[model samples]
Target: MGPVLRTEHLVSADQQTGEIASKIDAALTQLARARQIQRQCLATRHGLSPLQLDILMTVAAGEPPEPSISLLARELGVSQPTVTAAVITLERKGLVRREPLPPRRTLVRLEPSGQPALADRPFVDAASRLDPALQEAMLEGALVMIAHLVDNGTLSVARTCLTCRFHRSDGGHYCVLLDLPLARSDLRVDCPEHQPAA
Candidate 1:
């Protein structure tokens, strides 16, 4: 027969697992609530729907090699058509523009009209709702969770050096993938070069 587990030990293990699960659930719930509150405030301040505001924010964050509709859809966890529809609405409002590039790729960027929205107090106030240390902790937790989800196939996006095998934590952060050293603050939340750790 296999080794038998003591009843007391089993009960203790079960209780510990339950407590951890509850804490995770609470954290997720708090994040969801914060997002909802921020979305509501953004909608009220900008006279835009939450989805529109989300699209605008995503587009606003786009750097060179601007984000495509499909990429935005992937990041937002929505259908491309849904993102496209929102883009159309945003275009009508002069908040965003679609620039056609060669070879049939379209790039999305925030228009001048949308810049004012980014500077509004609602976004700042909502962001500051959480304490700075708490926000950093939450972001770190989120990055780790996202890395886990990506490894498990529950999520497909959010590639970061933290999840890459080449990431080294000795003394300071370093990435073998890029052959570059990274500072703690310089660590990217999303990196194109991220290769999942084996």
Candidate 2:
């Protein structure tokens, strides 16, 4: 008898495309759901909207000197006006303050009352509610992604700093980096490690 031959069915190009489209749709749906859940968590426990909470957390995590409106906006991926509005709201609530400082900027810091609200058991417990392993993994992933963005210039490491506005240079040489007076002309220069006055 002649050798028997067998043929297998193959997916058509349209079928393959449909499968990919379905996967993308599912992924988007999950992302939307996750964002909604996070928003609800912030609203229910913190008595603040997600944007409000973000503004508070941003100020809380600022460097010892605190951060200005422009710097905070850059860090939070929002516009200056958006940050300004949040700052105004926080100030009215006595949860933050706008201090007058060098560069003539608005500095933000969490008030004493705000600290307790953020540090309360509910807040801490809500944060702890997430799976530790998952949180760690997400943090690692975010770091890696941020590194890529920085390298690509999609994100900047050099924000407002000594050269930007906050740094007040007196006459005579003074600098941990160059051991010389930093000229005002160098303001536009980018320095990743620049530290501005608090």
What is the model-wide C-alpha lDDT for candidate 2?
A: 0.62
RMSD to true structure for each model, in Å: 5.7, 12.2
Q: Which pairs of residues collide in candidate 1?
A: none
Where is model 1 more than 4 Å wrong at Cα? 1-14, 120-139, 169-173, 180-184, 196-198
Q: lDDT winner among the candidates?
A: 1
Give one digit per residue, the lDDT tens place, for model 1 in 135-190: 66666666767878888888876667678788987867788767889855467776
Model 2 per-residue lDDT tens digits across residues 1-198? 996655455677999889987985697688768766866675567566666677777677656324788888877788999988978887887888888777678788789867744553343465477787755554444444444555577866544323233444464224555545644333322355565332
**Would you estimate the TM-scores of all the predictions?**
0.74, 0.50
